[model samples]
Structures are given as structure tokens and as C-alpha cells.
Target chain A: MLCFINGEIKNINEGSIGLKDLALQRGYGVFDYARTFNRKLFHFEDHLERFRRSAKELRLDLNYTNAQITENAETLLKGSDLKNPALRLILTGGYIYSPSGNFNPNFIMIAEELPTYPEENYTHGVKLLTYEYQRELPHVKSINYLNDIRLDPLRREKNVFDILYYFQNGITECPRNNFFVFINDVLITPKDFLLHGVTRKVVLEMANKYWKVEERKLELAELNSADEAFITSTTKSIMPVTVIDDKKIGNGTVGMKTQKLIKLFNDYVLQFSR
Target chain B: MLCFINGEIKNINEGSIGLKDLALQRGYGVFDYARTFNRKLFHFEDHLERFRRSAKELRLDLNYTNAQITENAETLLKGSDLKNPALRLILTGGYIYSPSGNFNPNFIMIAEELPTYPEENYTHGVKLLTYEYQRELPHVKSINYLNDIRLDPLRREKNVFDILYYFQNGITECPRNNFFVFINDVLITPKDFLLHGVTRKVVLEMANKYWKVEERKLELAELNSADEAFITSTTKSIMPVTVIDDKKIGNGTVGMKTQKLIKLFNDYVLQFSR
Candidate 1:
């Protein structure tokens, strides 16, 4: 895979960053990723907007403008052979701070093989584990996933696909995905203190047209009692959540609403590509 | 400076990591750094123990054992030209997860110049800015300084050396330093939901000999009214904190207790190095 790092395109294997890059040294960076369908970026502009916002929030100075990044991504995508790819925009706080105590932000646009989940996961849905931890600075997409990574063993042990985070405040979000649930025909997703994912935004818009879309605080008990549940992400799209912890949602099978939303999301993607 | 990546020692400038490294991609990594005084590591074993515990808590499979890392540090220090330097041990979650979903941890031991703070920062003391952000995993020392780095502008604008973190629960700690306060000759520091800093541990042991050391919840009001306050870290040692936010700490001059502790810490360091 070809990656654009510091205005130069290099092979994925050759894509190396200075060990002193703030992203690695302090995890001081922001990133946003968007997947490609039929070799075209899905909601490219929306993702870039969020990417720029994340950098701004973290006070990261991007070497390249959003327009330049988009143009570079287009060029890189044209030469890429992967039918579906995930393009990630990374902006680091830079190498060693200069004498002036300023950072030279390092920007990189890399393409990776789009992760392919099992067909059974989409058909039969996936189980989720519950964790009582809230991400720090949930609004910004910073490179801090220690809590999520530490929970990997528990995730594997529980045979779950992802973990849902809910603190005393309320249900926040998943490690990498935006969570939502359907209760009595009302589609609810957490309103604040969470990343406003592009997919979640699109899902909200789509669901609003057909269902009662509400953005508010959702508790674990409300989630367990949800008629149907699902998570949205660039890669996961709208995948159903059949079980959370030991509690089964509805009848332990994918509900009609979840299936309908998944189909609707797929159709929306097709329309987006066109 | 010569550094060690895995087993190979390379020039610090030439040392680099793949973009796919989990440390950069997902911030899945653990790191511990200790400063060398007069070409000798101060509290080497303590830092390593904390480093190992951090890696274990995060489930990071370090490529090298603690003994191997110590040996590499010694070798790297031998080849180094600097007198006083900081050695940082970084263990990343490694390359992309395999098909079976496993990470090959990447280990790197790098040396950098020790940060030289103004002499007045110790004698006249340093001012601190207070932030209301709590770290995600306070126990594990992950490469997540997003909250700290984000406060750089505020730190500079306020002309403070570092930012102190306080939540609804009370004063937690500083971004990089462990906070302490002296109330009526009793030394108190936050006991839980904070990193067990190596310097803090050593300071606690040393302070226990001369003063009453109590590890408990430290309220902001108590800190504001403290007789004297200080912060402990690998690099900062026992630097005095004269001002927090807009409140002046005990007449805003280095207190006798703080000075004595600093002297005690320096004397201990000299003895350790000998």
C-alpha cells in the first residue's frame, strides 16, 4: 500500500515515523479514518471536516490543508489496487520541540486494507461486554486507547466483538464505535460526551426519516431493555448488537428494526458511492 | 545519541517506527522514563518495576525482559556522550494484530537530553495551572499525554511550569508530577486514582523519616491553604509549588519544609549515585 507521509508517497512497509514524533512519544496526536467503497471514499468531506476539527481541538498544526489532503487521497486512491481501503489521516505534534518551544506537526495519510468482519457477525449479530469507563476527551479523536486495549483480554474471554462504556453519568460509547438502541420505536443515541461519528450522524439522519430519532442520556438498564440495538462506524456501518453482557436484547436475535437499519445503511452507501 | 530498538542500537535521529505500530495507530503502549544523574541511573529498579507493572496491566507483551532492558540501558548509557540524560523505555503493542488477533510488542530504549528547567523554578518555585481532566487509566503509565499537551497554550499563557489535575473527587495529581501539600507540618498527597510515580515512592520513604507523611484525598481548599507544597517526578525531583491557579501557596515563597525536602532528595540522590 502507498502512504503519503510528509508530502512523499512511500510503500506501507517503508512508512516510518521518527521515534521522537509527539504521536509516539506522548501520544499527542489526532486521527480520522474513512473507508472506501468501489474505490471511492465514503463521506470523504464529512470525515475530513471531523479530522480538521479534531486537529484544531488538540491544537495540532497540520502541515497540509484539508483540500491538499483530499487531493492527495484522490491521487493515492487512483493508484491503489485494493477495491476497499481504509484511509487514515494522522497529524502528530511533531519531533523534538524546537528552541522556540514550538512543534513541527507531522502529517501522514495512509491507506490500510479494510478490515473484513465475518459474514456471520452481520447475519447473526455480535455480543458486547460492558465496561464502566469513559474515554477522556471523547469529543476529540486522540490516539489514547490504553483502556480499550487493556480490555482486549476480557473481550476475548467473553467472546464479544466490542465493549460498551457506561459510567455513573450514563452510557457514553463503545471503544471504537458509536452505540445506539431502539426502545418502543424510539431510536436513542447518547447526546454528549462522545465522538460524533460520521456514520452515526448519517444513521441518525436516515433513521429520523423512518423512526423517532432521539439524542439523550441512555442508561445500561434502558439498553438491556432495548427492543433492538446496533453500533455504527466507518467499517462496521450499522451492525446489530444482540446481547450486552449477560442480558439478551429482546429475543436474543437481531430485531426487525436493526435488520431494516442495516439494509437502509447499505442502500445509503450505494447511493453515496453513486 | 545511540538508542536501542528491539535489540539493535541505532542513532536516535535514525530510529523510527512503522506507521502500523499500535503505539502510533491506536496509542496501545506503555512507557517509563528515568533520569540519569552524573551518568548513573537514579532509582533504576523502581522505574523498571513500575514500567513492568504498567506493561502487564495493559497486557503489553514486552519484547525484552526487565533484565534485558536494564542491560540494554547500561550499554546505551556506556555509548552515550552526555553526562545527564533521560532514558525512556517504550513498549508498543507492535505491528497490526494478526489473523488470530495477537500483537507483537515493540520495545525501544531511547536516550534524550535531560530537560533543564530554570534554577529559579526550584528556589523561587514554579506556578501551576489547574485542569479538571482526569486520566483514563491513572494507574498505568501509557503514552497518553493528550490532556497535558493540550494545556500547553494555557500553561504558557499563564506562565506556569505545569498543570495540576483536580476533579470533583478533589486534587488528583499534576500532568507529569505527583502533587503534595504540607498542612500544619503534615505531608499529604492524593492516595488513589493516580500514577504511583517512582520519585513519589522514594520521596514518600524519605519524607516519612523527617515528617508525618499521609496519603489521602487532598482537597483543593487544603492545597490552597497548605503551609508548603511540592511536586515530585523523575526529572523535577521535589520542586516547590508556590502558586496553584490564582491562589498563592503559603506566602508564595519556597517554604523551609520544601527546601529541606529538596535538600534531602538531592542528598539521597548523591548517596544513591555513590
Candidate 2:
């Protein structure tokens, strides 16, 4: 595995950050994850745009331009032999004792084999545990995952795929994925307090052509009336949700509409990659 | 400066963590800080007890026992030439790709010169800008400071000492300190949704003997009826707060009770260190 750190290419194992780095010191950092399809980065620009927004929101200065970052990522990918490569771009508030001090930002790009979910996660669908959590500064994809990582044991113990966070009875999102549900022939996803994932954006664009899409607050009680529910992310693209907190969603099976959306998303990705 | 990383002593500059460290990857880590007075750690046991609790709450395994960590910190301090030494102990979930896998925890101790606050921060008191925000998992001292660090520029621009976080009209705490107010001659501090700072505990114990101490929800509106206000932390002990959001607290000057509490806290530290 190879990674680019501070403009230098190095083996992934050799990539290290000092203790003084604010990413390590105060968990002050932002990151974006994207995957490549057929060795071509998918929706790289969209991911970069969001990454830039996250950095700007956190007040982190990115020394490299979008083109430079893309070039560095492409160089690392070309240098690797990964079949399904995933790129993780991390920009950290660099070494400084005081927050107001002038400090350089540490930019890192890691290339790793993209993870493949079990086929049953899509065929038989997966379950999710509902948690009442509202991420701080939810719009920015910061490095803070304390709530997600700490609740992982409970997630594994319950045999759920991931935790779905709801705040004030409104379904927000999963730990790393944006959630969408179909109710009364309408597709809906929460509009506030969540990372707008690239795959989610694609699905919205595709689904809008076939079905009515509403980007608004989806309540927890609304899940009971939902005909189908699914989540989207870079890795888990349009994965179905059969059960949530032991209650079966849409008769404990993947809905026909969700399956169609998955196909549509796949076709859209194929066209984009070409 | 000297530091300890997983039982090995190294220069502070050489203390580097891999990119895969959960502290960097997901910002999954717990930390506790304590300072030494006259070359000896003050209330070391109390800080260690809190640190252990924080690690347990976060489900992070501490590879070393209390005595071992204390001894390691002492060793690092002894090797350092800092006059007023402060120790930072960090326990991070070590390198692992998946959250379910077993990970080796990284225990780190860094010795640095203790920061000295301006004398006016206590004598004439300091101002705080109130912000409507809440910390995630406020009980455990996790490394996630995204909210605090991001708001640093705002704090600087406002020329305030720190941001006072209030959620649901109740004053929670400062970014790094526990908040207290002497309202109508009775001392009050919010008991929920904030870190149980060690200095706060010491102050509560000492103030109980001299004043009426109530650990309950301190409403933001109650600040108007307050006679005096102060904040407590390991680094900033009994620092008075005379103004909050441009509103003068108790005539916008350090009150007599706050001055007495500061002297009492100083005497307590001196006795503890001896």
C-alpha cells in the first residue's frame, strides 16, 4: 500500500504524524473518502468539492489545489495495484500549541483496497440500530467519530450493519452513510445535520427522474409508514434496510423500488466512470 | 522535551503515531491532563482515577496500571528540564482497519512546560462569549475538540477568554473548564452534560466548608441573579468570570467570594503537593 503525506509518496506503513498535529492533539481534522471503479476515480470532483467545503468550515488551509490533490491521488493510484482502490484524503490542523497560532496543515492521501460488503447485505438486506445522536458540526466531515466508534461494539453485538442516528425523532443518517426512505410513493432523505454523500447525490439525481424525491425531515414514526428504506455511501451504494431496532421495515424484505434504485445507481456509476 | 510512548522514553519531537491510529483515523481516544507544582504532580491520584474512568467509558483498554502510568510520567518529568511541568496522558485505539478487530492501545505521556495565564484573568477577571452548543459524550475526556478548535478564531475575534457553552438555556461549561456561579450567596454549578473536572471537584469540596454549594442545573437566565462567577480546570484553577456575553457579572469585577475561593484553591494545591 502506498500513501501521499505532505506532498511525498511513501509506503502506507511509513506514514506517520507527530503528536503535536492537531489531528492527534485535539482531533481537529477533516477527511473525505472516495472509491475508484475500474481503476478510474468515480465522481472525484464532487468528493473534492465537499472536501474543500469541510476544510473551509473547519478553517483549515489546504496548501494543495484541487488539481494538485487529484494529481497526487492519481499518482498514488497509478503506483498501486489495488483492484478496487479507495482514497482517503485527510487534512489536519498542523502542529501548534495555541489554536490562534500560525501553523501549517498536514495533508495526507491513503490508498487502500476498497472493502466489499456481503452480497446478502444487498440481497437479503441489512438491519440497523437506532441511536439518538446528533453529530457536532454535522455538515463538516470532521475526524470526530467518537460516538460511532464507541457504539460499534453494541452494533456488532446486536448483529446490525450500522447505527442509524435520529435526533428529536427525525431520522438523520447512519454513521457513514446517508439514509433515504420511500413513503407513499415518495423518496425522502433528511436535509439537515448529515454529510451529503456523493453516492447519495447520484441516487437523488437518478431517482428524481423516476420517482418524486423530497429532501426534508423524515421522522422516526414515519418509518412505520415507509414502504421501503435504504442507505447510500461510496462503498455501500443503495444498500437496503430490512429491519431497524428489531422492527421489520417493509415486511422484512428489500422493496422493489429500492432494488430498481440500486440498478439505476449502478448504471449511473458505469456511465460516469466511462 | 521528553515524552513516553508505550513505555519507551523519546524526544517529544520523535513521538509520532501512524496514520492508522484510531486517534487519527476516527478521532477515537481518551486523554487526561495534570500539572506538577514544585516538581511534584498535584492530586495525581484524582487525575488518574478520572482518566481510568474516561478510558473505561470509551471502552479503551489501558495497557498499564495506575501506578505504572504514574511512574512512567514521573520518569519523563525527571528527564525533562521544564520548571513548571504539565503532563498529558493519551490513550488511543491503536491501528486496525476495522472497528471490530482487537487493537493494541497506544499510551502516551508528554511533559511540557505549564502554561501561565495572565494575572488579570484572575484579578480583574475575564470575559466569555456564550455559544449554544453541547459536547458529545461530555463525561469522558475524549480527544474530540472539533467544536472548540473551530470556534477559536471566533473566540479570538471576540477578545474573550473562552466560549461558554449553554444548551437548552442552561449554562453547561466552558470549552476546557467547569463553570460555576455564586448566585445570591449560594454556589451553583451545572451537574450534567459536562466533564467532571478534577479542579472543579477540589473547589466544590473546599467551597462547601465556606459557602453553600449546589450541584444542579444552572440556568443561563440565572446568571443575571448571580453575585459572582468563576471557572475551574486542571490548567486554569479558579479563574474568575466577571462578564459573560458583554453583560457584567456582579458589577463586572472579581467578587470577594471568588477571590477567597482562588486563594483557598491555591492553598489546597500547595498542601496537596507537599
Candidate 3:
């Protein structure tokens, strides 16, 4: 594996950070994940935009600009044997905290083999467990995932793919995916209360051209009446949610809308991969 | 400075973690801060207990046993020239994430100079700004401080010492301190909606011996009628809040109860330091 640490390329085994990095000390950092298809990045600009936004939100200084990050990533990928790679860009609060002092941000980019999902997961869909919680900062993509990581045991025991978070009355996003449902032919998902996912934006934009897309509060009650449900993420693209908390969603099979969206997403990716 | 990374002691400048350390990658880690008084750690057991509890809450494996951690801290302190140092014990999720795979947790202990607060901060007390925000997984002492760091500008502009967090109905806690209010001669602090700080536990236990202590819900309205309010933490100990949101807290000076509690705390620390 190849990685970029502070503008220098190194083997994954050699990629290390100082103990005083604020990301390790106080979880003060922002990161964005992007994936490559056939050696080309999909929605690279979108990911960079979100990365910059998340960094700004956390008040973390990005020592390198977006162009520099992209250029470095491209250089790393070009020197690697990866065809379909997963890349993570991290900007940390830096090594050591001086009382009311300037910080030197740590910039790291890691490229790894794309995670391979079983074909059954996309075909038969996946189960989800409901968790009652909200992220600290919904808009910013910080490195904090204690809530998500802590639920791994329960998630594995229940044989679920991810945990869908809900705050009291409304359903928020999943651990790493954005929730969407087709309620009475109008595609609906929670807005403002969740991280705006890159793939979710793509699906929403493409879906908006064909279907009525509403970005608003999605009540938990509405899930029971949904015609179909699915989740969008950088890795999964659009994954159908067949079972949610023991309740079968839309006859427990992948819905037509979900299939259609997946097809559209695949087409979009393929068209841009070249 | 000397520090413990994993099981090895290294110079602070040479202490480093892999880029894949979950603490850096996902901010999935728990930490506890303890301060030394005259080179003797105060409430060392309490801090360790909390550290273990937090690691348990996060399911982070401490490859080293509690005894090992204690021994390492003692060795690090003995070898260092730090007097009245601030020590932090961190247990990260691991170096990588795998599906249904065990992770090798990264254990780190860092010792640094103790922060010095102005005498006026403890004598006249400090001002506070109120923000409506609640921490996620408040019981666990994770490195997630996004909300607190995000409020840095507001805190600096107002020249306030800290930001007190409140939910819809009542005050929860300050950014890094536990909130306490003396209402009608009874000392009250939020029971379960915040992290139970070591110093807070000490103060509560000591205060219970002298005054009425109620560990229950404290309504936002009670702040206005309260005789006094203060915040507690390992570093700050019992710091009184003179002004909260521009409103004077008990005549805009350190209340007698706060001063009394501070004196009790100082005496207790002095007794244990030797």
C-alpha cells in the first residue's frame, strides 16, 4: 500500500504520525474518502469540496490546498498498482498543543485496495439496526467514529450491515451512509441534520431529474409506510435496505426504484471512469 | 519529555503512531487526564478507573493490563524531570479496521507541564458563554472535542473562560468542565448527561460532607435563581463562574461556597501530594 504523509510518499508500513497529533490527542481532525474507478477518481471535486468544508468547520488548517492534495493523490495512485483504489485525505490539528499558539497541520493521504463487497449484498440487500443517537458535528466529516465503532458488536450479532441513527422523532443518517426512502413516489431523505454524502448528492441530483426529490426531515414513522428504502455512500453507492430493525422494508426485496437508482449510478460511474 | 507509546518509553519528540491508528483515522479512542501535585499523581486510582471504564465503553482493548499502565506511568514519571505534570492516558481503537477481525489497540501515555491559571481565575472567578449543544456518548471520555473546538472563536471573542453547554431544558456541562450550581443551599449538578470527571467526583464527595449535594437534573431556569455556580475539571479543579452569558453569578464574584470548596480541594490535594 502507498500513502502520502506531509507531501512525502511512503509505504503503508512506514506511515506514522507524531503522538502529539491533535487528531490522536483530542480527535481534532477532518477527513474525506474518495474512490477510484479504473484508475480515475469519481466526483473528486465533490469530495475535495466537502473535505475543505469539513476542515473549515472544525477550524483545522489544511496546510496543503485542494489542488496540492489532488496532485499528490494522483501522483501516489499513478505510482501504485491499484486499478480501483480507495483514498482517504486527512488533515489533523497537528503535533502538540501550545496554549493559544499557532498549529502546524498534518496532511496525510492514504490509498488502499478497494473494499470488495459480496455480490449477495447488492442483490439481496442488507439488514440494518436502529440506534438512537446524533453525531456531534453532522456537517463536518471529522475522524470521530466512536459511536459507530462501539456499535460493531451489536451490529455483528444482529447480522446487520450498518446502524441507522435516529434522533427522537426523525431518522438521521446511517453510520457511513445516507438514508433515502420513496414515500408515495417522492424520494425523501433528511436534510441539514446529516452529513451530505458525496454519493448521496450524486443520487439525489440524478434522481431529481427523474423523480421528485425532497430533502427534509424524515420521520421514523414514515419508514413504515415507505414504498422502498435505500442508502447511498461513497463505497456502497446505492445499497438497498431490505430489513430495518426486524421489519422488512418494501416486501423484503430490493425495490424497483432502488434498482433503477443503482443502474443510474453505475452508468454515471462508468461514463466518468474513462 | 518522556512518554509511553504502546509498552515502550520514548522521548516525546520521537513518540509516533501509525497513520492507520484508529485514534487518528477515525477518532475512535478514549483518554483520561490526570495532573500531578508536587510530582505525586492526585486521584491516580480514580483516573485509572475512569480510563478503564471508558475503554470498556468503547470496547478498546488495552493490550497492557491496568498494572502495566500504572507501572509505565510511574517509570515514565520517575525518569522524567516533570513536577506537577499533566498526564494523559490514551487507548485507541487500533491501527486498522477489518470486518470481523480483532484489532491491536494502541496505548499511549503522555506527560507534560501542568497548566498554570491566573490567580484571579480562582479568586475572582471567570466568565462563561452558554451554548446549546450536548456531547455524544457523554459518559465515555473520548477524544471527540469538535464542539468545544468549534466554539473557540465565540469563547475568545467574549473573553470567557469556557462555554457551558445546555440542552433544550437544562444545562449539561461546560466544554471541559462539569457544571454545578448551588440552588437554595443545595449543590446540584447534572447526574447522567455528562462525563463524570475525577475532580468532579472528588468535589461532589467532599461537598456532600459539608453541604447538601444533589446529583440530579438542573433546570436552565435554576441558574438565574441560584446563589452560585461553578465548574470542575482535573486541570481547573473548582473554578467559580462569576458571569454566565453576561448575567452576574452571585454578585459577579466568587461565592463563599465556591471559595470554601476550593479551599477544601486545595487542602485535600496538599494532603495527598506528599
Candidate 4:
């Protein structure tokens, strides 16, 4: 993979960073990722906006202007050999703790070959297990991921690819993906228990365009009996969830609504930047 | 400051990282910092034990042995010019995410000169405010620090150093310290809602040995009516809480028990270490 650190392109094999990025020190970071389609970056503006919001929430001052980050991302994408690349953007600590707001923010953009999701993984579906932990700061997209990292081992042990997190009240999200369930033809999702994912947002927009959607506090009971279920993320796109906690969902396969929403989502992203 | 990464000693001024260290890429990390007294690390073993626990909780495997980490820490400490230094230990994501029960880990550790804490601020007492966010994986000490990062910006805008956090129940902890309150000669603290800090642990041991101690959920009511209050941490050691949420704690100065605990805490660290 090719990576960009502070405006310079470097091979992932080479080490990068300076002493100042506390994201390396204290895990202070804010990042976002998206993919490109048809020679155009999908939801670049939306992702960057979220990235900026995350930085604002974390108080990590980025000296690089928004225009600069966007330009750099585009430049790095062009510099890479990837035609249909998955793009990642990362910003780390630059001294917000120094009593002065000055920070030399670490901006890294990496481009890699797009992943080919096994069609069945989304069609026949993947099984998921629920975790006991919840995101501490779900409203802002911050970089501290210990909650998810802590569960990754268990997921691996269980041979599950992802996790469904249940807080005291309801289901929140997957480690990196936002969760959704089809409840009686009305799509329902747990509100405020997740990062308000960009892809989830796209799904919501599509829902508004084609289906009834409800964003509220979702109870575990609702999820246990949902007609269908799926997860959304920039990378995963939309993948149907077949089993949660060993329970079959939606005839043990991807549902019709999910497939329809996937088409709507693709249309949304393809037209978003172009 | 001296740091070791990829098995080499490097100055903090030249601190850099590899792309694989997801502490930068994805904020996957676990770390702990313990101090040195007279060239010997205080609670070094405890710190390592907790570090391992933190990693285990986060499911990040540390490929290195405790003995190896200790040796690296010692080497880094010896290279640093500052004799009375505060140590910094960090572990980040390796190139691969291993999920099996056994995954060879990639992590790093560094020891740095203890930065000077403004002693006068503690003497005069510092002002702290409550934050909405709390640590999700309070046990593992992961690299994802978005909550702390977000609270920091507001703290900066308010010009405060520490951000006290309170969950829905009551007060939890400051961003980097644990809390204590003395009410009606009964020393007490918030339970489960705060990090079980080393200094806090030492204080509790000393208090149980010499005074009335209570460990349970603490409501804001108890703090408001407290006779005295204080906080503990490796950095702060022990500092009395003269004021909390604009209310005077005890005589609005260091409490008598706080004074006693402070004296005992130093001896505890020294005696416990050797």
C-alpha cells in the first residue's frame, strides 16, 4: 500500500511519524475512510466533514486547512497505482495538551486495492455475536477503539468476522460498522449508540427515498425479532446479517429489502461525487 | 526522552512510527506509565502486570516478554539525561490483527523524563469541571482516546487543566486521576466508575490501615457534604480537593487526612518497590 504522511507519499514498508503526534503517544486521534468509484471519490466531502467534526470534538487542532486535506487526499489517490482504491484518512495528536492549541497534525492518507467481498458473505450472510461493551463517545468519531479492540480477540476466537455491541439498553454497533434491523417493514436503528455512520447515513437517505425509517432507542427485544438485519460502513457497504448470537435472521439469508437498499445505496454513492 | 521502536533506541525528538502500528492507523493500543524513585521504578511490576491486563482486555498481544520490556525500559531510562524522570510506556497495533488465542504481537515501550508538574497549582488547588464522556474500556487502557480528546477542547476553552467525568449515576474520575472524598471522618470514593489507579490503590491501602474506609457507589450528595476530598494518580501523587463543582471541600484547603495520606503515599511507593 502507498501512504501519505504530512503531504509526502511513502511506501508502507518505510516508517513514518515524528515525536509530536500523541495519537501515537496517548492514542489521541481522529480519522475517516471512504472509497472511490468510476474515477470519482464517493462521499469525500461527507467523510471529510465528519473527520473535521471529530477533530473539533477531540480539540486536536489541525493546522492544515480543509482545502489542503482534500487536495492532499486527491493528490495521493492520483499518485497511487490503484484504479478502484479504498482510501483511508488519518489525523493524530499534535499537542493539544501543551496548554497551547498549536499542533502539527499528522495527516496520513493511504490507498490500497479495493477488497472483493465474497458475494455470499453478503448474500448467504455472516453470523455476528453481541458484545457487552458500548462506545464511550458515540456521537463523535474519535480514534480511541479499545472497546472494539478488546472484543476483537473474542470475535476471532469465535470465528466471527464482526461484533454487535449491546449497551445496557439496546444494540449499538459493530466494532467498525453501524447496525440496522428491519422491524415490520419499518427499518429501525439504535440512535445515539453509534457514530451515525456515513454509510448508515446513506442508508437512511435511501430509506427516506424508498422506505419508512425510524431512528430511536432500539431495544434488544426489537432486534431479536426483526424481520431482517444488516450492517453498513464505508468499506463493507451493506452486508446482510444472518445470525446474531446464533439466532437466524430473515429466513437465514439476505432479505429483499436489504438487496433493494443496496441498489439504492450504490446509486446514492455513485452520484454523490459525480 | 528516549523511546524504543522496532527494537532501536531513538530520541523523542526523532520519534517516528511504522505504518503497521495501528495505534496510528486505527487507534489499537494499551499502555501504562509508572515512575522511578532513586533510579528504581516504583511499582514497576504492578505497572507491567496492569499493562498486560490492559492488553489482554483489549486483546492486543504483546509479543515481547515482561522481562524484555523491563530491559528496554531500563535501557531507555538510562539513556535519558533526566534522573528524576516520569516514565512513558506505549503499545500499539502491529501490522496484522491476530485473533487466535496466540498472536505474536508488535508493541513498543519508552521511558521519558518526568515533565515538571506546576507544584504551585496543586498547592493553590486546581479547578476541574465535569465531562459528558467516560472511558468505555476503562480496564484495557486502549489507544482510542476520543472522549478525552473532545473534553480537552472544552477544557481549553474554559481554561481548565483537568476534566472530571460523571456518568449518569454520579462522579467518576478526572481525565487522568482517581478521586477520594472524606465525609464525616469516613474516607470514601466512587466505585466501578473510576479507574482503579495505582496511587489511589496505595492511598486506599494506607487509609484502610490507619482510618475508616468505605468503597461503594458515591453520589454527588456525599461529595457535596464531604468534610474533605482529594484525588490520586502517578503524576499527582495525592492532592487534596479544596473545591469541587464550585463548593468548598473541607476547609477549602488541603484536608488533614489528605496531608497524612500524602506523607504515607511516598513511603508506600518507596517501601513497596524494593
Residue-level lDDT tens digits of model 2 in A8-36: 99999999999888888788899999899
- Of the two candidates 2 and 3, the one with more favorable lDDT, higher being better, is 2
* lDDT of candidate 1 over B184-238, digit per residue (tens): 9999999988898988998899899989999998877787569888898888888
Residue B14, candidate 1: how far off, in angstroms? 1.4
Q: Summing lDDT over every window of 10 consecutive residues in candidate 2 chain B, give the lowest-scoring window.
A: B96-105
Between candidates 2 and 3, the one scoring higher on DockQ is 2
TM-score of chain B of each: 0.96, 0.97, 0.96, 0.89
At residue B67, candidate 3 shows an lDDT of 81
Question: Ranking by DockQ, best first?
Answer: 2, 3, 1, 4
Clashing pairs in 2: none
The whole-model C-alpha lDDT of candidate 2 against the native structure comes to: 0.90
lDDT of 4 by residue, B1-274 (tens): 7878767778877767676566776677777888887777787788888888887766566767878878888888888888686677777666666444433355566666665568765676666666655576665556555566555557767766577777775778887788888888888887785568887777788899878898888776676788877777887788766766666776687767777787887677668666
Query: What tens digits encode model 3's per-residue C-alpha lDDT throughout B115-182?
Result: 77898898888898888888888998999987777777787788889888888887889878998988
Q: Is candidate 2 or candidate 3 better by TM-score?
A: 2
Cα lDDT of candidate 1 equals 0.85
Which segments of model 4 are wrong by more than 4 Å? A62-71, A156-161, A265-274, B63-67, B98-104, B130-133, B156-161, B168-170, B191-193, B266-274
> TM-score, each model?
0.95, 0.97, 0.96, 0.88
Please write out the lDDT profile of model 3 over residues A31-76, one tens digit for every residue.
9999988788888999998998888876666767778888889888
Predicted model with the maximum DockQ: 2
Clash pairs, candidate 3, are A143-B26
